[model samples]
Target: MINGILFRQRTGLPWRDLPACSGSWKTVHDRHRRWSADGTWERILRAVQADADTEGRIDWSMVSVDSTTCRAHQHAAGASTRAPKIPGRRRSPARHRSDEALGRSRTRPDHVGGDKAYSSRRNRRHLRRRHIKHTLPEPRDQRANRQRRGSQGGRPTGFDKTIYRRRNEVERTINRFKNFRAVATRFDKRA
Candidate 1:
């Protein structure tokens, strides 16, 4: 039964389409929903993660977190097939002017590679409060402003070019996640 659920998850197949070897599709789907509602799945994960942690198999030092936009699949769009998938691909009087519409087990990471978009002072302060060291590059404008302020500019943010280069690891991970049809389709309308 569990294998049936696993099969569906990996292939992104609808419940009814799950192979018969595992069990009746209805039973597999119902079991999945039941386990989900009862927190059984979360319990299983916690148990596995705990065992792995004790065995020194899991790394807790740093966790990369990032986000990206995924296009809605045609089936997900219902009858609204006329809407342009690409924003601003064509300009028409009737075309909408909108450009685009855009988990947390770990409390914190020992270190983080940050995007320039997250280089705001508030974000930095939050990380500092959590004692998280981040490798975030300052924008040119921010650098110029600090220089313009002279003595009142405070300390320059710590940036390591070597560390910033590793920021792509998170990006690549996100891209890999997009490879899953269930995710790429944004079927649930949420990430």
Candidate 2:
């Protein structure tokens, strides 16, 4: 069933097209839906990350955050609007407040690098609050606007050209995820 689900994700194939060897496609889909709704996948990711951290194989020195819009297929539209309730009593306060969208590592990274698209005042302030150093280049228009305002515009945000160069790594990582057809062109209708 896992294999069936992975195959569908990798190929962006219709659930009905899943091979018989992988068990019934309906069964695989059902399991996926249940696990996703219950945050099983998030738990698994956190567990794996914890193991890696314990083994001293995970890096916390730096991490990047960025978002990409995957063009949804026609079939990917019209998911139910109701939010799925996670199954279980409330956990620790920290765990409950953690952002799952950031993935397994909720710890603040020493440094973060992102593209201009992520260079918003709100995002910068969020990073500042977390004490995570960031390297994000200001957009041209924003730079110009700040300059036009003279000293009243406040000092230009710090930018490190050398550090910003590493942003390509984030871009490359995103590109790798996009290599999976289902992720590249969101075929799942469920949000």
Candidate 3:
């Protein structure tokens, strides 16, 4: 099952078109659905991350964060909706987000770099709480809001041009990852 999913990720195959090398496509789909519902994928991703950290592959001295929208196929929309909604629930998850696994840890980076999308107060506070210096430019709206509040608006957060230069590392990483046709092509229906 694992090999099938990894193959899909590598080969950009439609889930229904998963090769029979491992098992029936139905079995792979069933397993993927069950794992998605049970947070198994989250656990697996975190485990891989932890292993990388343990192997000294993670450098908390510098890190960056950004989000990208993956265009979804129209056919993908109905899968979650067809599932029975919980009592009193209003809507299906646009994208499921699961909890961090036990033992998951985020080290304090010497410097953090991100774009305007990450320039929210809550994100800044979280980084500050960890004592991680950040170089994200304040958005124009946030600046205006702060100025409007006068003394009540805390001082503008610090920004460092030099540190921000390292933000390209994350962009490059994304480009490299997307160089794989499967990743770039959005073969998986889900985010």
Say which candidate scores most in lDDT: 2
Tens digits of per-residue lDDT, candidate 2, 1-191, equal 77787888889899889988989888999998899889998888767666666566756665666666667687766666684432222221111123344454555667888778778889888999988898888999989998999998767888888877766666677777778898778677665
Model 1: per-residue Cα lDDT over 98-190, one tens digit each? 111102244456776767776778877888899988877789999899989999987888777876776777777766665666655534211
Cα-based lDDT at residue 82, candidate 1? 62
Question: In order, how many clashes per candidate?
Answer: 0, 0, 0
What's model 3's TM-score? 0.69
**Candidate 3 lDDT tens digits, 48-146:** 877776666777777777654444434444436656532321222121112245443554567778899789899889888978788889999999999
Q: What TM-score, over all chains together, does every model reach?
A: 0.68, 0.78, 0.69
Find the candidate with the highest TM-score and give its number. Answer: 2
| Model 3 pairs in collision | none
Computed on alpha carbons, the lDDT of every model, listed in order, comes to 0.64, 0.73, 0.69
Model 3 ranges with Cα > 4 A deviation: 79-81, 84-106, 144-153, 176-191
Lowest summed lDDT window (length 10), candidate 2: 88-97
For candidate 2, what's the RMSD?
7.0
Greater-lDDT candidate between 1 and 3: 3
